[model samples]
Target: MTFDRRQIVAGLAGLPLAAGSASAQSGWQARFPELVMAVVPAENASGLTGRMEPFCAYLGRELGVKVTLRIANDYAAVIEGHRAGNIHIGFHGPSSYVRARTVTNGGVEPFVTTINSDGSTGYYSVLYTRADNPAASIQDLRGKNLCLVDPNSTSGNNVPRFAMSRMGIANPDQHFARVVYAGSHENAITAVLQGTCDGAFNWWNSEQDSNFSRMVNKGMVKPEDFKIIFKSDLIAGSPYAWLTALPADAKAAILKAFIEAPQKDKAAFERLSDGKDRGFHPVTHKDYETIVELQKFVDQMRRARS
Candidate 1:
């Protein structure tokens, strides 16, 4: 489904005034006693929840409303939460955000995105294999089992397919002996290291910041155990979005809290970025138009395969 730019612009223009005179005195807390922030866990659910606790508390303190974290099982669940209005805020990968927008019909608006330490607004999708595996490239891994993160993942699935077609492997499902979704970035990496799959697509901002690097730093895996065979061009950083129905003042307050978290809530900010980000930066739908087009292309590819 294509988005109407005029409708989106008109809706955005009236968002802040949505709460109207009722919110003028008491604000969103009166109407929304509690807000849920939904996320698809990349690692251990319990651990991720723990890591995000302080951030949720920070938001709660800033907004004068109770904020709770909801660990969604998959990307589609997160998208569905936004579509159903069960979730008030979301942290979504680029491709999944586009899917959410598509499913929600522009009900959600991206407010901010993470800025990499190098000051880039994007990250790379890398194809990896075990270090001991003789397979050195995507070609070498032909007819081998492959692991992907999620169907709606930007780096894990979308960019991987796009990059593979560029490399002359147009259909990964046909090229590989088997293709499977590991459901999370950590799962994809683990499958590769454990020999459950020959290769996997995951994200990398730099050697200093990535799922692999974070795992390595945590002593979960050694750096020598894996090798990167291929890397895709920079994909837009994921976004933290909110339902546009929120009061205008509430939106401003939420954005202000996020932009100031780097200084005011250093530990929570570091936890969110794994200590490798500069900070959060404002972004709009326009920033992800290319990603939306890419998602459309992938959707067409899927339909053709079916």
Candidate 2:
């Protein structure tokens, strides 16, 4: 995946950068000369590079600095960038956020999350198979090959695995005939449809938007061609987070920009989200404690294998 700074038209007014409170008044400009932002490679780079340029320009104009966008090759690169203090702001899935937060020794804190069309801050991890398959649930997937997204994916891996654990099928390697990482949500669904795997994992908003829906919308797949085998409870959406080491004033401006970007520029916001999301809502580290706990559970299961 090629990560490059995109050239986008500028001069859009960002939502108010500062509030009336005294705390909001700081030399934010002097503190932040150049801002570097990264997004985990959740989709193809070309699409993101085209869609995100306006958002970056909005950030640049509001923060009184130059914003350089970096699309990472994979989740690990984004997490590593955050840990090394190279990325000032990042977009990360819940599972990757937890891992980055832990690996960075709590140096990353979430400030905002995507607000879905249903006004929820979460989505669901789902399993799908060919319509001809007799699988009614994940339990039926035993002895069948499975396609999973990356290990750091939330709905793609963490929540779905947890659901399996609750169903008394905690050990996927032992249950499935074989498990393969399809590298992305779209790929996972495609793998199942193409017969590369009998089952696949993906995620989407509870209100009718997901990887499957995206594919269907693009004419890549049809609704009647697949069956949902399992769906996990609401998993938190990805977040706009910044390294905790960043100065509070700058972080405040970044959060403010994120919170208001959708309302400020609907087209840019919609393009950036790539979903039926309304906007961003405030979130904190405490908000992600559930994900932290989930990661802990996943870790123990992996440790048991070692």
Candidate 3:
């Protein structure tokens, strides 16, 4: 058959131009699995991979979609991907979620939160000092080195900073000898343990099965090596969110799958959900109002310092 240039041009022009429309219609939408699951390099990448691959495979099988894992080097990269909508579904810390929302002009919405096995959706940021250190409260750490997890961490930095502001200990930089970003909560905890930092801030729930307690019990760190000098009130847990442009059916399916997953596959669910949190629960942007308020406070503080 002879090629028809004009006819071909017209045909091509009429083809669907909407991004991801074809895939969405086929019920096999794509997602960045690694980013969506918050698998970090420092946290035993091999173990994370081993644990998540099967989980992703299971989700894909049950959801009737293909899921691909994408790993970014740091939290900022993950946040950027989320802002750009390259990542359809993501697990983001509260501070990172706030930044993503700010950059995207509120384009994202929380669909569900990973619940603890006990069905709680909250965690706390704890301020720790060496067991031998005399600091009794956040105020006592004045003129000392303070190690923070990261700028984009919720329990690691944002909540701790907000807590300090509430306690009238505004700007640890001014009060402390210096403020150091340890890059990760584990690092911050390590810094305090090694005597490199006078104190450190980290996220954990007091619940016995919480991540922090699990780490301590697993001998990842010695609980006796540090003491909690301060702790923030429970903050909402991280979210599993999607961009607002996601189709309603897909959104509903995703939420339904997550919320109902634990009952279907208890063993697999236990591996992903933090011990006490049962599973994901449906949520909306309104649920994160406190986070938005916290971000505003942080932004105001940044401006004041500048």
Candidate 4:
């Protein structure tokens, strides 16, 4: 089937504007053994899929089913996949998961969130400028071009919007000389280095491992080459989400897979998470209430602007 970006966004993220066709029934596990897991494509899709194989294999064993991985090229694709019942499990950003409930009309449930290296179930949404930009603060970046990750991204767009608003910049597009969507964290980081934008919005694990650090390690750039101008209070971590349409037993098994996968298959989980994550801790919609509220605020702001 052809990739459907439009349907995905319709069921994924609002166009700053804003489906419930799910029915959770028993025997879903028996009827559908191929559990389709959708992952947000934060980087190269093919490479990510290959790197995730070992973890998927391990999950398959735990569920006693065949696990098929689908790399949704952006956050919205994963959301739509879930709404269309094409996805069983989703490794979702906090903002995307929060948006899923509204987009799916309550067809999704977040079960657990990754615990980062510092033992927190969250990370930071940060702004970075070139090392020599001479910008000491977000105020300094006003009238400068900026790059943001996907609109559905937590650190990339959602939290940045909220944080920027709180910083007294009610309009990033107007304050920043120009606003560009860099598509992914890596791209946003690269954009700053390549002068695509004056600064960028990205994220960091609690360990301080971020796009900059990752680039530094890859010989792509130096740690001193970028300056952190703004860092939002920790946003809820990425979540292991499930469709409400799944059978109760299936959901239980999936949640168990997340909770135990780290301890039982430490190396695989670490490999899957690129060493930025430790494991998942039990969580509920309430744990992300702040993000829910933030999203509401973002919607209100966008509406007011329109």
Candidate 5:
């Protein structure tokens, strides 16, 4: 888990600094002396910070500025940070990025999104229950407790609701005996494993790339202890976005660093990607249009509840 800082620095020396020219580095740095990158709490704060620090350090060296990492308390905090112009870059789930765009009025733009190790750019929302729970499907869990990761979580909340609605369970709150927001993906999975909830919705990319897989790798949960009872259609992978207001040169520099990470900063990329992603692919708002529509649907559901 150690990154070769000297190797990374040496490799980055040949890459374009800013706007494809070394001279523009000072111009972009003058505008953004320090860049703050914020992320949602997909895992515990300490673990997330440890995983992100190397990537942040690599980005800082490539950009010639201090790149600070902030593990947001929740998805809303990341969105709010972008809205307030405090977060220069945000790593967000698809639905959270949609919300960030809405709140900022297109102020944030997605520069790159994850590419799965299988070469796909999407993942699934899965409804998981204890393997011995006898619930073969989401329908079998009627009148049972359900755990959602967070309101802004795509796989944990929005896509689950969308999949459930298609299954005729129009109102999850009413359909389930009780519903709870676990606030983060790890927490939601933990609730289900602890029997605090009968089931939880979380993201799964493949057999090797998933929240469950990561936990299993950490020995936090056994793979055989839980089963996915339901799975949603492919949802776009999470994105790394930045403020559109930043200088064009800065945006180019940031995007360049990410696009080159897999080659120039292999260890950081592996740690950040959990060895389950191929690399970052250039992306735009158009790539997330379907998610934008889905978030709007979830927003309407929220308004009705209020």
Candidate 6:
């Protein structure tokens, strides 16, 4: 668990300092002058660096502080960076955020999330079947082949499982003729389209930049190619969180920068918000209570199974 100080310092050097700032000011001096934010790759990509460059630049310029983007290969690495205090801020899924908060003992707090075009702060977990599938509802899917995203995914796995459980479908293996883990939302969608699975579960929101739309447009599956049989209640979207150890001034500056970012740099905001359909909005730890509860239930179930 030992990190090289030189390497950490080198990473921080890439961060931009606030305008006219002589020295970095924060309650906890950054191991380096720049703040490092970590994000999980969506489809085995190395990181979000390539996707979020504009957003990172906007943050640096607006906050008068250096902001650096770090990509983790998966969700667990994102959590680990937050726990180790290497990541000053991060964009994390609800379940991963809850786990990170627990590990840090309140050291992290969500500050902002994607705000949909309709001004909604939440999204849905959609259970979809092929266009011509006879299944009209969760109950009707019994004995059919099913595809699910990763075990750790929120809308992809957790919410869908919760929905099925509530509907009295206790075991998918018994209900579905077969069940397959597709690893990613896109994979699940593709499985259903290719006739590999009768149904698939994934997240759907107004945020347009997501790969979901890409797959749809690529003819992997048309909008009309599937039917949504179940949709979960709107759950809080993922947030950009900061470590509690950050200085009050630095934290305030960063929060203000994020809130005003859309106004100051509309293009950048749109890019980070996942396309022109949404922008960032203030969020807090309490916003994800429902997700936390869901994670607790999932964990309990996992332990019981083990």
The TM-score values for the models, in the order shown, are: 0.91, 0.88, 0.83, 0.88, 0.91, 0.82
Worst 10 residues of 3 by lDDT: 1-10
Instruction: Give each model's clash number.
Output: 1, 0, 8, 1, 0, 4
Name the best candidate (by TM-score).
5
Kindly list the per-residue Cα lDDT of model 5 for residues 49-79, writing each as its tens digit.
Answer: 8889999999999999889787877888788
Estimate candidate 3's RMSD in Å: 8.5
Native-referenced Cα lDDT, model 4: 0.78
Q: Any idea what lDDT model 3 has?
A: 0.67
Residues 211-260 of candidate 4 have per-residue lDDT tens digits of 56756766777777788888888788788788787778877888898789
Clash list (residue pairs), candidate 6:
16-66, 18-64, 18-65, 27-247
What range of 10 consecutive residues in model 2 has the weakest lDDT sum? 6-15
State, as a TM-score between 0 and 1, how close model 5 is to the true structure.
0.91
lDDT of 2 by residue, 1-306 (tens): 444222111111121222123333347655556677788766667656876888899888878787888776667777877766667788889999999899999998889998888787888887889999998988887899998888888888888788888999878999999999887777788788889999998876753577677678668899999988777878877888888877777888888888788777777788775648888889988888899999999899889888
Tens digits of per-residue lDDT for model 6, 1-306: 112334433454444332123475543334335678777544433224545778888888866556777765456666767766777887877877888898889988998887777777777888888879988897898888988876667877788888888888877778889988786677788788888999888777743534466566445557777778877888778788888777777788788888887789888776654454556788888888988899998887777667
Expressed as tens digits, the lDDT of each residue in 1-306 for candidate 3 is 111223222323322213444343354243322223333322334434554566666666666765544444455655666555556666677667777788878877778777665557877888888888988988898899999877778877788888888888787788899999886666777788788899988777664654356557547777677788887888887776777766676677777777777787666677664335667777887878899898888888889999
Please tell me which model should have the higher lDDT, number 3 or number 6: 6
Query: Where is model 5 more than 4 Å wrong at Cα?
Result: 1-25
* RMSD to true structure for each model, in Å: 6.4, 6.3, 8.5, 5.4, 7.0, 5.0
| Among all candidates shown, the one with the greatest lDDT | 5
Q: What is the lDDT of residue 11 in candidate 3?
A: 28
Residue 130 miss distance in model 5 (angstroms): 0.3
- Which of 1 and 4 is the better model by TM-score? 1
Candidate 2 backbone collisions, by pair: none
Q: Report lDDT (Cα) of residue 199, candidate 2.
A: 94
Candidate 1: residue 41 lDDT (0-100): 55
* CA lDDT, candidate 6, residue 278: 56
